[model samples]
Target: MLPTVRHLLSQPDLDLRLLTPATTLPERALEQSVEWVHSSDLSDPTPFLSPGQVLLTTGTQFDTEAHGDELYTAYVARLRQRGIAALGFGTEVIRDGTPDGLVDACLADGLPLFEVPYRTPFIAVVRSAADMVAEERYARHTWALSAQRAISLAALRPDGLSATLSELSHQLHHWVALFDASGTLDRVFPRDAFAGAGLPGTSFETVQREAGRLLGRGQRASATVLAGGETLTLQTLGRRDQLRGVLALGGVRELDAASQDVVTSVIALAGLALEQNHALAGARGHLRAGLLHALLGGSRDLAETISTEMWGPLPSAPVQLVVTDAPAGRLDAIIEFLELRVEEQPDRLFFATQNDRVVLILDRTGRLLLEDLCRTFGLHAGLSDQTDYRDLPRALAQAEQACERSKEGEAGVVEFDDISRQGVLAFLARTDAREVGRATLLPLINHDELNGSELLKTVQVWLQHNGAFDAAGRVLGVHRHTVRSRIELAETLLGRDLGTFHARADVWAALLATASVPG
Candidate 1:
């Protein structure tokens, strides 16, 4: 603990009395740095004065011997210009009395003056100040070590995570909570502090990003909780600064430097505990990556493996397959976020890619859960039917295809089956893929579209009507002669008659191909 100013003043070896002095100056005067001290008998002490110095001089220096009776008082103006810490005068050198002119000058100018009487050597006083500060630093370093040991023991005890945190809080005198990667409060020791409170705490998704930056810059952070009144957050980082957790102190008194160290040590210990927890949970986590690979490649065994290992033989292994548009390592954090969210549920499982596209699994209906996950993790997901593992790959494929069709799909959410076509949509999707398809009919479409002839429109209308020309003309809003002229013009461009079934089929396929290509 750092010694207070009162402690230094109370030192026995320094027999200093406050001459012309009272007890303490106002609190605002504490911030000044000491500049220099001198014991000179010159009448013009003001010339030697510099800003921030606690000028030490004998009382003779304040005498009006050479200058007028207002001489000592005139130094106040120069002292104010110097902005010194305080003027110290040895009372023995000037008859143990402070000059009235100096006293009056100080009160008028607001310059503090200290009267250093006999029996206390200035060297002894300076030595006492140095010793006090040095002792304070030593004490702080020792306390830091003791706290460090406690942190080490906190990680080793393994008595439940809550017990460890309780021990940690006792040592640091603060409330501690271990939040998993999910925003939910996984463990809050001394549960009474937040037992009924809906404040589950913010997620590592938010905290880690911030804590990581602070640790990266070799800085410690602290904040007051506006929501919880005196509640305060004093956080730094833990083991390799992995952002294990945050330490909070809620009290009316401000935390001292020692308290800050204790809280930081607790966070470091909590980091180790959490990393251990993660290792323990890794086996359960391995399925997510495998699930992602399986869904992407449409592998059956991978899905079955996930089902048997995670949500075994059940009535309905309700699941949603999310498809991410990224490759790898780019979205590890989002995948981790999904994992943490799923971990909260009794029977939820999720697999996601590095690009943040994901598949989430829950036993019951997942509309609420999916919405929560999307809002929490900040990733849009294509919701799919909750079927058994057998259908996951297909659901994922549909979601991905739907994503391709949605203009805003890259925003990272898409649902399969919803984007798929039916009837004319389905026919249009595959219209140009048939063997007697556009590869053989492109020349026909090119011929009609390039020539600006109405033949392509006529054929499209005729095909819609199943080859009924007058009906097609009615749909086209043109006369039969006009439609026939367009067809004749199309035939002329194609160097083939439009009467044959093969020629008509070619024109139909070409039109489909032209429409199917994404604009």
Candidate 2:
């Protein structure tokens, strides 16, 4: 450990005496580390003094009345602001003792002050402090080297990146968390530490947002978020302009050089690990595509063979199928999300893209698991009842129909077993539906488009509520008067009385027909 103010005062050979009593100086201030001892006669020595320094000076310029006591007080205040450990006033300069004004100022400021006898040269003290600092630095360097080796070896273990993170957290005495490219938490050391803490609550969102901005600007970036008075640093992973993830660390103070070295090593190891995982995922994607082609091409034997070889055997006889039609422009993100889930249960879960839809086949019990994943991504999906391996073709068709129906309502999910026979009308092809929809409701749609109106919505709501204006208004969260006016406008544009049975049925079908249109 580096020497402190109290340690220097206790050196009997140097004959140092404390001008400020022990009670006046805080225990923490006495134990504060002193990295170096500096001697100066300049009026403003703050410019030359570094933090954690013990400043030694004589009363050469202080033995006067013209400069005033406030001037000397301000000098001590400046040193304190610069983080000087303590002030040592040498005796036998122009005066045989320390100046009364300086002593009073030091005491008033609560700064640690001591008297250095004339026989003890300032050079001697400087040498002692420098040696102590050197020794501490050497110790830190050795520890850092040993930690780096341990972390590197852990990176090579079966647990790989997880082991590296565990070692890093242990060495640094801080919380560590890693997130993937999707901003999803991948690993955290001391796992339960963030359960009730806000370190990764809102701080994670800020980190991801910062990472996006940094990637756009082609610069490396770090964000410091304070959580419960602890500082959390979020650093971008991967090279500039190609961020792969984010790494976060929480600590009470800034990290020392040794701890920082461990962080850098972890970053490098994580980058390499991420690259390896990416390559492996690509290879697996190719294999999955091949297996999917085999299944769809009606080669059951080969499909079963490949699946059995790569993954475990298919569930005995009864497996469920799930088909998804993601929100526009979010298919890639949804796929990434689902892939991560699949990786968690490689034997029990399998998914691949067929045509424009994502198809998943898992054990019967895992059907609900697929539903949860789709709901998490806000995706529209259709699930089929359990069926044997030979019936996949029919099961897939049912799942596709169910998925198409899912787009008609707010639930964003549908099971073949849940839909009524009449709801089958929702499975009409988009081309045929659009043609009929345009022929029946094109006038109203065009009118609404041109006038920026909610006439169409009013008509749909009115039909949904069995043509009751008050009921529809309540559902629309509007007054009946507004609903009546919009319905009247829609009737005029369509040239039909929506109150009639045939007109009501036709308009309802047309509204359902156009419900699948992309916004």
Write model 1 residue lDDT over 111-203, tens digit each, in one string.
Answer: 666566677777665666666667777887787788767666655664545566777667656656554332234455566656546434533
Q: Which stretches of candidate 1 lie over 4 Å from their true place?
A: 1-27, 31-88, 95-112, 117-284, 287-315, 318-320, 326-330, 350-359, 362-364, 371-386, 390-408, 423-519
Give the clashing residue pairs of candidate 1, or none: 322-358, 322-359, 324-357, 331-354, 382-414, 398-416, 399-416
**Residue 387 lDDT, candidate 1, scale 0-100:** 64
Clashes of each: 7, 0
What number of backbone clashes does candidate 2 have, counting pairs of residues 3 or more apart or in separate chains? 0
Q: Global lDDT for candidate 1? A: 0.57
TM-score of each: 0.57, 0.77
What are the lDDT scores of the predictions, listed in order? 0.57, 0.76
* Model 1 TM-score (2 dp): 0.57
- Clash pairs (backbone) in predicted model 2: none
